[model samples]
Target: MEKFYPEFSARFAQFLEHIRGRRIAIVGHARPDGDCIGSQVALARVLGTLGHEVLCVNPDLVPRRLQFLVPGMRFARTDEMLADRTDYTAIFVDCADHARAGERLKGRFPVVTGNIDHHLSSAGFAEWNFVDVHSAATAEVLAGMFFDNGLTVDAQTAQGLYTGILTDTGQFRFTSTTRRTFLLAAELMARGAKPTEAGFELYERETTGKLQLLERFLASLRMECGGRVCVGTLPNGIFEATGSTAEDTEGLVDYARCIDGVDVGVLIEERPDGAMKASLRAKNPAFRLDRVAAQFGGGGHACAAGLNYKGGAAGFREKLVAAIAAQIAAVDTPEEKK
Candidate 1:
């Protein structure tokens, strides 16, 4: 058990010490992605082994693919957790802010005891915050802490950590993937994480509806800002027509981002209520898509961010394109900063 993130590990150890012997409820964001669910599962299993009563709570059900990581584990939906009315120490995992945990859960735990995340937009809304925007994933932070403290990572917990690291790193292809990420991934594999299993569940299990949804999204691709920006749309009825869901739109935006010469990629999802949810991705961190998303009250990493607007897709797209153009113009004008 070697220490990778010594400073973060020490801080996490102190946080754990403060909550020692208390009943803990681990909270994750609304849409529990691999990193969110994996972090919750891994931390809950580790903390439970440390003699604390722990349960993972989320606003939504675990996505179909991520369910495997929670097999035989204690996971409660937000409603269920609220029904308990139990007094417990609240720990949030992979949530950039308390709002990301949903308004209901945010109200339940007005003051978070512990907050662990890796999103650059994290609001640090906890008494004990261990946010590492540089880390690839929240699970990466917890994995480092687990190993640093000589804690045991059982097979299931290892799989959870491995899945988080794998997905958050974009299969280890994202810029955030560091040498420590690879090394910790290797350690998780040694501890019993099966990459093949994770890959099959994550990538190979795409549904036909998702493909149909992706088709519509691709068909809506439009280049702006002299082709440096690529924007796509999923119309209001597209999901219902394709029998797909919000989860299906997960990696669809990447298709636009991966295109040659596209520095910024945007996916605008039109909700049933006419609101538009925009997911933004950039190849270079300098673009600072997070700041761009913040203009619409959304936040995320520099390379990947999102926002929601209560307006028509056409108008939202126009406004977003203009914002992105301004960003590109500002970046091009290095003299402005000076």
Candidate 2:
């Protein structure tokens, strides 16, 4: 076997030794996506087999699409785990920053044991921060680490890790998907990861309400920056109107980005409480959407990023457009012209 993560695997061995006898809480970000939930489950199961007591914790409930990975497992939310008082050593996974787990969770676990992630903007916030920006997903980082360190990955863990890679790679169609990703997926299948089942759960389970929501999103699409950018807005209360939830916004932005000549796609969700949430996806990694999201205190990979802000959507939209537009102009203009 080729050592998938040779360097990180050695560090992982030290991490395993560091927390040998401690109870662990695998904390994930709020409004958990496939990668977040998948990484949490995969890590929890692996650690559980090592005679370590482990629990999965998240700020929000596992979304519908990712529920398959959590069978027979109970996830502790903010209140449940905070009241347990188990003295859990926090191991944050797939979170770019402390705030990604929500302010309340961050306050509870100010000090962290380990942080494993693949986001380009990941902040090294833990004692053993294993971040590989080149990996397509945090689960990929963990899978590599586990395989390299000779850790056991049962059937369920394989599915969890496989789902993380599948979703984060845009179903293996995104530019981030690499040879290692496919090779890992193949190995995972040999270990009992079912691609057909995962595909059905993640994609084929879309409801009529979700289609309605997508209709609204498509209708709201507006081309900007001379058609190079496609922006869609979901108005406040639109979820109620469409009979859909935030999770339904999952792949809506991709429709915008897949269009011809559109370099970037955006989905801006307006909240009733005056907070704004935006999802940014770029066809080209050169767009560095993560940097654009960082300007607003959000972060992720270069091609995909997101942000949450406390303000009117319109005001935020203007600022976001200007930033993205500037990025576009920088690429368009010749260096000598400047």
Candidate 3:
């Protein structure tokens, strides 16, 4: 067992020491991806082994594909956790900001005990913030730290960590994937993570409606920003028409980014409430799609980010396209930073 993340391991020890006795709540972001859910499952299992009473809470229900990671009522909805009288010292996993867990959960835990994440845009929001932007996924950081600490990683926990790494790395095809990423994944495999099942469940299990939904999304794709970017829109009620849920939109933005000469890809989902959710992806970090997203009160990794906000007088799609175009313009003209 090598010390893959010695410094983070040390901080994890300190985090454990700080919340030694109080009941701990592990909170995750709304509409959590694999990284969010995986980190929550891994942290809960790891902390539970330490004899601490732990609970996992999320603003949204676990997506269908990720249901395997949640075992036997391990996760609770925001209202469910709030109903419990037990006071919880919260630890946020894979959340870029304290508000990433949504306002209600943020209200539930006024004082954050810890936050573990790997998003490039992550701010140190918790008392014990363990944010390693270099790590491909927060689960990668946790897996390395858990191994470095000589902690136990059961099969389910290993599966969760592996899934998080797999998804966040774009199946190990993203630039963030490194030798260390592969090494940690191999170690997780040795610890009983089944890649075949993870891959099959995550990828091969797509429903027909998801396929139709993806078709609609791709059909809406248009080249924007002088062919440097591709944009797609999923209209409100498209989910109902296609018999799909919001989770089916996963990986749709990648198709836009895969187009030739497109430096950035955008997906704007029109919600039923006149609000919008957008996902941004870039072929290069210099495009700084996260910075583009930050303009709309959302942030994430440099190459990948998202935001959910109501469209204003200017229109969200028009505004978002302008922001992205501006980002590209800045990159195109290096002298524009002023």
Candidate 4:
């Protein structure tokens, strides 16, 4: 409201001047989602247009579906690309915290020149931090920055920005979706973003392997807490059996949340490291899923959050179920009585 962070434009101008003609590394968070990749590519396009050499670096390959939005998004193996970060200006995007950039990159480029993100957990990790958690998407913040700085938004830039907004807001269906989000989407469309094509590519272009993986995940869905919570797990073996990758499981958590009578959805993805990554989503505004995620050292928006647990996969699942149950119990507790 009232134009969150009025000084962002002026500060961004200063950052641009400082990094002109420099070899810049645009880093996104690990296991990047659409918002992460979109913000990175969009910002890279702007930086490149300003006569700066920019490299968009992500630890994981761009999701096959998102590749169409940011064509040829530059990606690098973390161990190889960040081995030496001596002469590069680091700019992080859509990451909540410094650690989200991975320890290797964080160690190499300790001095972050800029950060662009919309998560509340971003506690000013950069010399020039642009964290506006109020904004619906980091792409919304990026779009505002681009317009404020008089940067021309072309097809490539528009596509990237639109993708960031779409995914972060769950195609504008999430509770965070606001009038300003739609206004930003319209602005991006006017700048040549093809929303129709993007919708089909992102939502409709899943491969058979991904579909099978989803089927398996859905098959494992469990309803608990008198059907108020829905839980699903995607084991590593399921990916192998279905010939799917981590990216294929990206939005599968939403499927569980979409079921009737399920106010909270829990998705646990078993990782090769013997750990599980838990993504929690809420259908009811009364639910505070971030609190559930914080039990495992993660924090995010109320409606969406995640946690990483180091334990046997089964043990992690058991712990997560208990955590979710505790959250549900708290919701039913009377405030005054407590």
Residue 28's C-alpha lDDT in candidate 3? Answer: 93
Worst 10 residues of 2 by lDDT: 329-338
Residue 195 miss distance in model 3 (angstroms): 0.4
In candidate 3, stretches whose alpha carbon ends up further than 4 angstroms from where it belongs are: 334-338
Better of 3 and 4 by lDDT: 3
Report, for every candidate in turn, its global Cα lDDT versus the true structure.
Answer: 0.90, 0.91, 0.90, 0.82
User: lDDT by residue for model 2 over 41-122, one digit each (tens)?
Assistant: 9999999889888889998899988889999776999998778876989999999988899998998899988999988988
The Cα error of candidate 1 at residue 125, in Å, is 1.2
Tell how far residue 111 is off in model 2, in angstroms.
0.7
| Model 3 agreement with the true structure over 1-338: per-residue lDDT tens digits | 56888778888887788888778899999999999999899888888889888889999999999988888537888899779878899999999998999888988888898999998878898899889998999999999989988889999999999999999999998889999899999999999999999988898899999999999999999998889889999998999999999989999999999999999999999888887899999988888888888899889988999998875524778889999998989988958543
Give one digit per residue, the lDDT tens place, for model 4 in 215-284: 9999999887789889998877788899888888888999999998888888988888888888999986
Give the runs in model 2 whose Cα sits over 4 Å from its true position: 336-338
- The per-candidate count of clashes, in order, stands at 0, 0, 0, 0
Cα lDDT of model 1 by residue, 1-338, tens digit: 45788788777788888999999999999878999999999999999898999989999889998988998888888889879999989999999999898999998889899999999989899999999899999999988889888888999999999999999989998899999999999899899999999999999999999999989888999999899999998878887899998888999999999999999999998888988999999988888889899999899998999888875656678899999889888888978442
Q: How much is the lDDT of residue 183 in candidate 4?
A: 79
Error of 2 at 154 (Å): 0.7
Ranking by lDDT: 2, 1, 3, 4
Residue pairs clashing in model 4 are: none
Models 1 onward score TM values of: 0.97, 0.97, 0.96, 0.92
lDDT of 2 at 129: 96
